[model samples]
Target: MMKIMLVDDDRTMQAILKTLLEMDKHQVVLWDGTSESDIFAQIVQEMPDLILLDYYLRDRNGIEIVKQLRQEPQTSHIRVIMTSGQYLRDECLEAGADAFLLKPYMPDELLRLLHQVQQNG
Candidate 1:
């Protein structure tokens, strides 16, 4: 089972993802979007196998977060799957995400990507 981190500002999204991931036998870690300053540190500490990051966060965009993560040795190697309501797959891939899922995606799509990433890793 993979340890996954869900970083999004929406509590409802977090709850839904947590339940889905748990049901899939993955451990879920929620990032409370309270402070962007501490986000990197929290993620580094958590060191999850994969991060499911939303494209638009309240404090900052996921692109910036993914860029920062790619720059840091502590987080550079972790798998990241970026999600968005808009179509930004190219941008997300350029920012270092392993994959991008447009919001309202099917659970099977997410699971397939998760499995694919896990296998590739």
Candidate 2:
């Protein structure tokens, strides 16, 4: 099991993600039913193995968070998956996401990506 963070602003998405990850025995950290706040500092302290971030968050864009994580030496290596309804694969990749997932993605797709990341890393 891996320690993963689900950083989407949508409560439904967060619940779904948490349930699915927990089903597979992966430990999941959430936004605690609130918008991601001071997320950069929180992430640095928590240091999960991976993060699944929404492209357009309630408080800030996921790319900005990704960039900050990459810029900081301590959190730079954590894998991030950026998901959005809009097309942002290239931009998110450029921002340092390990993978970009379009919204409404299937559970298997997300699971496959996680497996791949763990395998490669």
Candidate 3:
């Protein structure tokens, strides 16, 4: 099972993602905050297989988060999937997200992406 980290400000979304990922037999770690320093630290320490980040955060933007993650050598190789309810697909891709998922995504899509990452990684 892949270890996944989810970062979103919405509790409902976090809960839903946790349920879906766990049902798929993947381990999940969730955070509702947007402190880049803290989150980056955790990512380096845990070294999860994938990271699902929300486009909109309470403290910082997803683009900035992606940029920071990419800039760090330790976390740069981590697969990042950015999710948003409002942003365009190209924007997330341009900001360095490996994949983009719109809000209200199907569980199958998430699982498929996870599988693709696992295979490619």
Scored by lDDT, the top model is: 1
Q: Using TM-score as the measure, which candidate wins?
A: 1
**Per-residue C-alpha lDDT of model 2 across residues 74-116, encoded as one tens digit per residue:** 9999999999999989999999999999978899999999999
Tell me the lDDT of model 1 at 93: 99
Off by over 4 Å in 1: none
Summarize candidate 1's per-residue lDDT along 1-121 as a digit string, tens digits. 9999999989998998899899999999999677977778889989999999999988699999999999988899999999999999999999999999998998889999999999999
Which is the winner by lDDT between candidate 1 and candidate 2? 1
Steric clashes per prediction: 0, 0, 0
TM-score of 3: 0.89
TM per prediction: 0.97, 0.94, 0.89
Task: List where candidate 3 sits over 4 angstroms from the true fold.
Answer: 32-37
